[model samples]
Target: MPAPHGFEHLVRGDEIVILHHGVRAATLRGAKAADFLARIDTEDPQLLMARLTGNYRRGNERAARRHPRNQS
Candidate 1:
């Protein structure tokens, strides 16, 4: 099946690599490739990454432990 609009995909070993602007933006294994390919461009990669990996929290105390938002 073809990738949804705005996405280009390639198969490397056991992974399907999704590229944006020629960068290695994301990779999906065979099982999830179909699910990802069904998505539209309205979804942002950053948000999808956060949802799939659960590691993109933006406001955790550790996230700002050294770099305070009010730094002058």
Candidate 2:
């Protein structure tokens, strides 16, 4: 699959705000924000953002189970 996009982050003081498609997705504070910043450039930003914002696994289990390769 193509690399994920439309995810960005903003630092506000000690907090980090994650945005998806120009809207607020999640707000990380304290150690969470620190960890995110440390990995932001080292890891896949889009996937990390998605996972952090709880969008990575949003209701996709059923679809995955129904895939042809998953058939019994």
Candidate 3:
């Protein structure tokens, strides 16, 4: 997928606050926060933030489930 837009992160002491479209999405703490900080510089920041906030799944999951290809 194309790199997501409108995703941002903020570091607050021991916490990393993930935001999507100017709204709070997820909060990473301790190890998670550290890990995110480590990877943020090396990877696609927007995509990483989207995944961290569990916002990567943007398609219609319910429709995909009902598609003929998905039928048992």
Candidate 4:
């Protein structure tokens, strides 16, 4: 089956990680994995974190860019 949306993994040495955007949302031990999965799958988490950090701009697509690698 396909992996859930917004779920991604990383491997380094002996550990594995799950991330949402660049945030370290979970590890193999699964402490906050449920909340992280729920948060990312159901919400615009990059936008959410931007809002929380007072970095959200109203209707600002410029921040998301238009380059192929940076496009939303």
Candidate 5:
């Protein structure tokens, strides 16, 4: 499958990193999307740290608050 748009690939040491809009999204030491997703699914510490420091949760919370279904 083709890589996601707005994402660029980079190699660092033995790992491959995916940069989305110039920010890192995923990384795989073996350079495979499946590995990347699996690592993310397992909540690899590095990925978790990145997500926590990044805007992922913040953006999701904002969206949830805006959705009508979330209104009480």
Candidate 6:
């Protein structure tokens, strides 16, 4: 089967992969397989990287403090 909408197909070595919005979705060996499955699925890579790097915006600290879960 073909890849899903908004996905681009690519081949690396002996593996076939799908990229969704510039992020890796899945990879399969060989080229005779069906549709690829999403592995490291994510919506926004930038936001994910920002969160990982502890780069939240200035006001976000206050907002987090206001939340009940962050009180501790």
Q: Which candidate is the best by lDDT?
A: 2
RMSD of each: 8.2, 4.4, 3.4, 10.7, 9.0, 11.2
Cα-based TM-score, every candidate: 0.39, 0.75, 0.79, 0.31, 0.39, 0.35
Sum up the clashes in candidate 2: 0
Candidate 5 lDDT over residue span 1-72, tens digit each: 222245455667777676767888767655464455556657554444345335333346667888999898
Point out the worst 10-residue segment of candidate 5 by lDDT. 49-58
In candidate 6, which residue pairs get closer than 3 Å at backbone N, Cα or C atoms, i.e. clash?
Answer: none
Which segments of candidate 5 are over 4 A away from where they belong? Answer: 1-4, 31-69
The alpha-carbon deviation from the true structure for residue 70 of candidate 4, after best TM-score superposition, in angstroms, is: 41
Candidate 5 backbone clash number? 0
How does model 2 fare in lDDT? 0.90
Where in model 1 is the C-alpha error above 4 Å? 1-14, 18-27, 62-72
lDDT at 23 for candidate 5? 86
lDDT of 6 at 53: 32
- Model 3 residue 33 CA deviation (Å) reads 0.3
**CA lDDT, candidate 2, residue 64:** 93
Off by over 4 Å in 2: 57-72
lDDT (tens digit, per residue) of candidate 3 on 1-72: 456889988889899888888899999999999999999999999989988887897778879999999999
Q: Which residue pairs show backbone clashes in model 2?
A: none
Top candidate on TM-score is 3
Candidates sorted on TM-score, descending: 3, 2, 1, 5, 6, 4
Q: Count the backbone clashes (under 3 Å) in each candidate.
A: 0, 0, 0, 0, 0, 0
> Cα deviation in Å at residue 14, candidate 6?
0.6
Candidate 1 per-residue lDDT over residues 36-60, each given as its tens digit = 6556255765455444543344555
Show the lowest summed lDDT stretch of 10 residues, model 3: 1-10
Q: Give the higher-lDDT candidate: 2 or 6.
A: 2
